[model samples]
Target chain A: MLPTPKKVTVVAGSGEGDHKLTAFDNALLAAGIGNLNLIKVSSILPPECELVERLDIPPGSLTPTAYGSLVSDVKGDRIAAAVAVGFSDRDYGTIMEYSGHCSREEAERAVRAMVEEAFRRRGMALRDVRVAATEMVVGDRPGAVVAAAVLWY
Target chain B: MLPTPKKVTVVAGSGEGDHKLTAFDNALLAAGIGNLNLIKVSSILPPECELVERLDIPPGSLTPTAYGSLVSDVKGDRIAAAVAVGFSDRDYGTIMEYSGHCSREEAERAVRAMVEEAFRRRGMALRDVRVAATEMVVGDRPGAVVAAAVLWY
Candidate 1:
């Protein structure tokens, strides 16, 4: 079996760039997680994983992450992204991601609700929840917003 | 630095389900990879990684993968997905994914071309190339096609 991640961190950021992918890259950079290669995973936090304040991964390393992002090229368009992590007692946690043409608060609320729903569906009692969110308004160039739960060994 | 993957496998499958996500899940199961947690990564095969005929990962393990998938709800519609890996003599390889409303042959051609383009852009001498693809026709339920390069320790 592959080793489970021991540390996790939540981060959010927004940015504008020349193109949509670049905008996304810039948003990830703003979120302080642009250097590593991100492997996107579905919502699941292993049991006994610890929440950390920051990640110290090297460039080009393969890093597992759960993220939500939105990009828009239309000027003045608002975009938001958020991620929520729900913890349970002595069991695995759940992660939820959301992105939409809405406010940061709305995105956060939606992701939290999704986490709660996931916990309910699993019959797990939700002990705590943590959220991170970001919003961006497009300017002359493409804009993007990203929120992520980064998991590492 | 995080440990790099040492083994890789190419797999493809198609399936039908009541919904899109389940359709995708069924496709993964058909491909023999549904039980694990997939971490989707961008196009890169680590240097010196060996190609394996199959993966032997445990259930619920976090498996890194590069993949392409297509889902269709319209009855009689055709969906195809393909993934290609281009290898260099002693350097990291490139992986390309493509999905479209086309035949499996067309999808395979497209993905292989993308891998060639990637090699050309990187100024790398391509030593070999491998591809996997799948196609599906939608019926009463939603249908999905998936092609993936599974990476493991």
Candidate 2:
């Protein structure tokens, strides 16, 4: 079993590169997370963890995260990504993420409804919800955008 | 202010496109979330929220979410992304995300430590945690990977 993360943060960034791959790396770098290895995982916040604002991880460190991103080579094409977690006064919570071809406002509104529906399905009363997101249009060069909920030891 | 999300879900997907942007869209579709708009948000799972296995969002509906993604055109290069949330029985939680060039295991380990340290700083004891992630080696065509925490009304 993997070690459980104690605290978490939210982060996002965007960049352009000579190639789609490079653009992604540049975006990670812009988000201050370019140099490390990333391992993907599912959702489930541990009990007792705290939330923070920044990811100060060292370069080359293996990092785990949950996030959404977009990379496009089509000029003038709009891309967006967003993440949100809903929490009540109780100890349980739910998480959601989305990415697509649209404006940031459109994306945010869509995800918000999803958050509310998630709570309704669980029959839980929500107290507050928090979010982070990014949006961009493809230019002459390949571009990328990202948003995430980051966790750490 | 938007309505607070009561529940959230995490998701991730990967795909290859003729171009980098299409690759991201295809990946979102593969993850079963391509049809909706995405709103980015930060971490913080509401207390008492429940975790579900799949997203049954309607097509063309707006959705709120938090996520990380990448698209690469570098052939034979490995890429990965991860997201995790930690929660205690208490009323708080933490989230983390990572992306880079490496194996999935390496990234997962790194993020686990990040979670631990995050809690250590907060002086909180962790009871449990959950995660989502993805990894792939790029081929001749462009490829993408993503992980996310999604929320709904």
Candidate that would win on lDDT:
1
Which portions of model 2 miss their true places by more than 4 Å?
A: B1-153
Model 1, A28-142: lDDT tens digits are: 9999998889888865777778999978998998788989999999999999999998888967787778899999999998888777765665577999999999998899999
Which DockQ-derived CAPRI band holds candidate 2?
A: incorrect
TM-scores for every candidate against the unseen true structure:
0.63, 0.50
DockQ of 2: 0.03
RMSD of 1: 5.8
lDDT string, candidate 2, B1-153, tens digits:
124455557777778889998888887887778888875544445554466777877887656565667789999878877767666676555456566787777656655655565555446787777778878888888998877776665
For residues B1-153, write the lDDT of model 1, one tens digit per residue. 557898889999998765554566578878887656687889699999999988897554688889999888999999999999898998999999999999999999999899999999999999999999999889998888999999898
Give Cα-based local distance difference scores for all models: 0.86, 0.69
